[model samples]
Target chain A: MKNRIITISREFGSGGRTIGKKVAEKLGILCYDSELIEKVASESGFNANYIKDAGEYAPGGFLSSAFSHRSSGPNNADYLWTIQYKIITELAEKGPCVIVGRCADYILREKADCLRVFIHADLSFRAERIVKEYGEREESPEQRLKDKDKRRAAYHRFYTNMKWGHAQNYDVTLNSGTLGIDKCVDIIKELY
Target chain B: MKNRIITISREFGSGGRTIGKKVAEKLGILCYDSELIEKVASESGFNANYIKDAGEYAPGGFLSSAFSHRSSGPNNADYLWTIQYKIITELAEKGPCVIVGRCADYILREKADCLRVFIHADLSFRAERIVKEYGEREESPEQRLKDKDKRRAAYHRFYTNMKWGHAQNYDVTLNSGTLGIDKCVDIIKELY
Candidate 1:
């Protein structure tokens, strides 16, 4: 096969990151998840923490309209997206890899032979996984899951002008809750 | 753990039936697909071929409206659904099983511990598979695949009052085009 890039967009608590890592391990390729933040931060001269905080979140309506007047200048979200887009395209150009979130699918859509995937799970299943993995110290796991999915969907829509998790936008979609992380990884590896 | 039922709703040429069979074989449980038509026919006293022809297809508008006045006398689609609903419920009540298509997920929603899965693939992939499996004697394979998917979607929507192949309606969704049929079977078996 030629250079094939796999981009994963997933709901929070869907085990997408784990699946991506396992796929990369199996395929002997690189996987980018939170590590993407570090790369973008280093390249854009932004703090990693700031990039993490702004990751996969669209600016609010007021801020977006406020930035509209200075479209040439670009807002914080736009700047972050620009830097991330450049990084994603560059990474795809380098070789075969698995990329998680960060709108990498949309950014590298036309640039690479990409198989875009979306991973999701039922709400209760995701809530249970979230509570188990992250604990319940912050917000209710269910609420947090919903909030994160919403934010990711908003960010994806804003950037790509398309629905975040729609099947039409993806080459494939899987439910990590139904198929365990290992099985999900196996499926992805087979595809790769 | 307990007696669990798996319902697979699939797009045409997505290898859903094959996956269901493999999962059932691995789990040592019964799998229902076209065999459902036989059961429904035997139970309802309808001819098997007639039932198969009417299977999963909603009645035309004229017949539906004609049956509307005498709601007690269901149309061919409604009668088939009624018998299949009873058969599905009875099968679930009996033991663990894998049921493919026929809105099994919706029918057994309240009666059993069901894992609802939707299997799909890209159009070109499905078209290729259809050609390889059923040969190119039919209309164009791509057109056949699209027409079959549209019919299945319509049937599911009519019966379940939900979008067929929608991620929201399923516990998990898999792309057999990307993952391959055997891997899909393995994933479902692992879930089982």
Candidate 2:
């Protein structure tokens, strides 16, 4: 585990970020989740909040993707992705760590000895967790879950040209709903 | 682990079958891979070879799927699926076991407490293993791998209305290429 990096891609409200943090803590390595947005924001001169949202979640859907290649260089999301990609690689080069989301799995696909993971759970499980973690919102937890997952998937496909959360792309895919959060962390550590 | 079944879905030549066997051995449970085809053949009166090939892998590609809605009674593949589904359910009811391929995971998704696992590997890793296991074929190992995986995916979609090997469909997915066969077996057993 000296130089092995673990990149965690997750469904919304699946507790994947929490599991990544716990695993990194157990392994005594840095866990890059929100820290990545700070790096991107500082380097690209974008607002931290904007980078947090736009860095991982695409602004639009299929229509935007079709028009994304109009030779206008890179759009905002695309530009953010380029900066995040650089920052993510630099962090991985600095040391082993657990990177949560921001397409870190795809970014470090070839450069490092990386253990790519995808964590997901049942919709009901995620819905409950989102309400607990984010507090009640005007939109139902399920609706919010769907929107976040959709936008994140679009952002991933737009940048990586790979389907997000596909099992073939990752070394391990864990269902936190069935296995629970602690078990997921232990399993990831075991694999790492 | 009482009354808990484990279903394994895998890419061809990924050592999933081997892992399933070893896990069942360690857990002292029955592992049904070819045993399933024999049971289907005995009950369905179809040739064992035919059931072996057509039970998990469909006969044709997208064209056949498009035309499968004909007024005629269920086709042979569809009929076999019905029988396999029944037998798989019956087996799960009898006792906990490891069921491989044949979309047993989907069949038991709701009826049983299933630890659904998908196993896959890098193409080069699987290709080398297939040659060692099955002997060299007239066609390259890569060609055989692609053809088998495509048919399996089509069969899964046509029968289950679910994408085959999707991360959302399973509790755990193991990369035998990176984790190795023994580690994959250990991980599945740990989750169980």
Candidate 3:
């Protein structure tokens, strides 16, 4: 009913980005997915590749090139977080927009107006999505799912210093793979 | 009020266990926390020590000492899940209770009477709790908090295939450290 901010976290193939785009369009609002990345890169003056790299490093991810080797030290965390916080806070202050990932829900935890949604699908459905999206890739469905989730988990963990998918962490956890994307959006629209 | 179940996810050292115990005592129901390990130990035939070790694997934790790892295959996830699922279902079927930690909220998501709550305090408050709990052997609150949470995240992820601590996963997220335990419980009780 009011101008609102909604943050979404979804599995790679769950159509979270697609659904977020649709919801923003339906509501006649701007949606931030890749755009948020660009803003994050521009605000931090970091290479888009680095922002993209750090974006993949969610809370659970440990940069093997850094943390594993014990070679990274403070600079890595500090450098990446600068952009992470800057982009997320700016977007929050900017206006209502749909964020696909980057733990936007956790990023805006203190904001009273934000509604956080966790969108997920069954393994089979998500696997099918990966298969369709990357038909050229030789990797199996299971391997693709694993890689995407691992990166997602790692990125979330490194940033927030919290676990990635505990249900207690989210506002609404749904099995979108089974419910279908539109039905999921309908339910979320009702929730908002 | 009708009988119901409350799922709690808390920051380490925030006295979530104390808060959960008190709430369960008030509601006249069982509180499942560490008890989950024992049940998993029994049902899965894995020793409690091994289950604890399996949990400690911490993300890539499995790659570290997985030889003794207690739940290797996807079917098993991790050792703690068997216990978590068993306890959650048993309690839900038995009637309402307060289930704490171990991703009880996610496991019991199917139940109609479930109320998921995340109780978190500021770092200083959690640090104080850990300091009090460990006494002379106590480590700095931040380190203790990180280790404890990593273990928790690993256990939940290995078992449920879900990330931990993201806000989108829970129904209501509250600042327990700021609100204090009594107020936290009271607010949850009112919501329930």
Candidate 4:
């Protein structure tokens, strides 16, 4: 495990963040999720909420991508991507760590030895988890799941020019609904 | 381990067949690759060679699928798919085994507890292995690789209505080029 970087890209409410944290704890490494957003916010002088939103979700969004092409020159998403990329790389360089989301997999792909993992689950499973995790909202869990996943995917595609969850791009892709969060962590740990 | 079924879908020249055999050997279970093809051919009353081609490759090919829908009645591929579906289902019912290719993953999607695995490698890695495995051919290895992968994908898509090699469809997707064949085997074995 010389290149001890693990980048976890996960679907919303798939328990990917939990799995990442558990694996990092087992490996005695830092798991960067919200910590990453804070870092980017600090580095880019943007509000933490703004960085969290724009960093992962696309501006025009997955459904409204019909109007994404209108902007030009270092847009907010692009700027946040640049800053996040630098911070992710620096974090990888700093030491062995687990990075969840923000395309750390793509950012550190060539720069570091990374065990890039994509975590996903069935829509029903995700929808249930989101309700329990985020609490009930006006929007149904399924609809919220769809919107968030689409935006994240759009962001990944827009920034990296790669299909967000395409198996080919990652070293391993795990179905958390089938495999379960604990098993997913165990698998990542086994590979780690 | 109650499911006792492992379905392996792979890109050409990824050593997926070899990996499946090794895993089966280690698990003391049957690895169905050529044996499955033979069974399909026997049951369908088609030549083994024809079954090998049509069972895994789409008619009109992947690159040239503009004319794929001209036929109305059950065509050769559809017929082969039916036989394959039957044989694969029966194999799973028999016991735990590693079933390779022919859309076994999709066929047994709900019928059995299958550890569906997709194996893929970089184009360059596959190109190098094809020459070693299949021997030199008039067509370049890369071209052959492209043609084969496309047809396999087309066939899987046509029959299953699922995207070939999509991560969402599998429990685990491994990159043989990065993880190496041995590591891939060990990971699958660990999960099993």
**Highest DockQ, which number?**
2
Give the chain A TM-score for each candidate.
Answer: 0.91, 0.94, 0.85, 0.93
Candidate 2: clashing pairs of residues: none
Per-residue CA lDDT of model 4 for B1-192, tens digit only, reads 445799999999998999999999999999999998988887878899977877666656554544656566676776777778888898889899999887888888888988989999999999999999889999999999998898888888877789988899998999999889999999899888
Off by over 4 Å in 3: A1-3, A45-50, A58-78, B1-192
Shift of residue B180 alpha carbon in model 3, Å: 22
Error of 4 at A96 (Å): 1.3
What is the number of residue pairs that collide in model 1? 0
TM-score against truth, every candidate? 0.78, 0.95, 0.51, 0.94
Candidate order by decreasing TM-score: 2, 4, 1, 3
- The reply for model 2, stretches above 4 Å from the true place, is A59-63, B57-63
Across residues A85-114, which tens digit of lDDT does each residue of candidate 4 receive? 888888988899999998888888788899
Give model 1's DockQ, 2 decimals.
0.28
DockQ of 2: 0.85
lDDT of each residue in B1-192, candidate 2, tens digit only: 347999999999999899999999999999998998899999999999988877655644343765655667677877888899999999999999999998998898888999999999989999999999999999999999998888889888877889888899899999999989999999999999
Q: Mind giving the per-residue lDDT tens digits that candidate 3 earns over B1-192?
A: 334788888777777788888888877787877776677677778787776556445333543423344454543343355555675677678777887876777777776367777776667777777777876455666887878777776666655666666554555555555445776666566555
Q: Per DockQ, what order, best first?
A: 2, 4, 1, 3
Pick the lDDT winner: 2
* Model 3 agreement with the true structure over A69-180: per-residue lDDT tens digits: 4444556545666667667777677677777787788877875366566777767888888778767477778787888887887777766776666544554555566457
- Which has the better lDDT: candidate 1, or candidate 4? 4
Point out where model 1 deviates above 4 Å.
A22-29, A47-50, A59-76, A109-116, A128-140, A167-172, A178-192, B22-29, B59-74, B110-115, B131-140, B189-191
Which window of 10 residues has the lowest lDDT sum in candidate 3 chain A? A58-67
lDDT, model 3, position A117 = 68
Clashes of each: 0, 0, 28, 0
Pairs in clash, predicted candidate 4: none
**lDDT of every predicted structure (CA atoms):** 0.80, 0.89, 0.68, 0.87
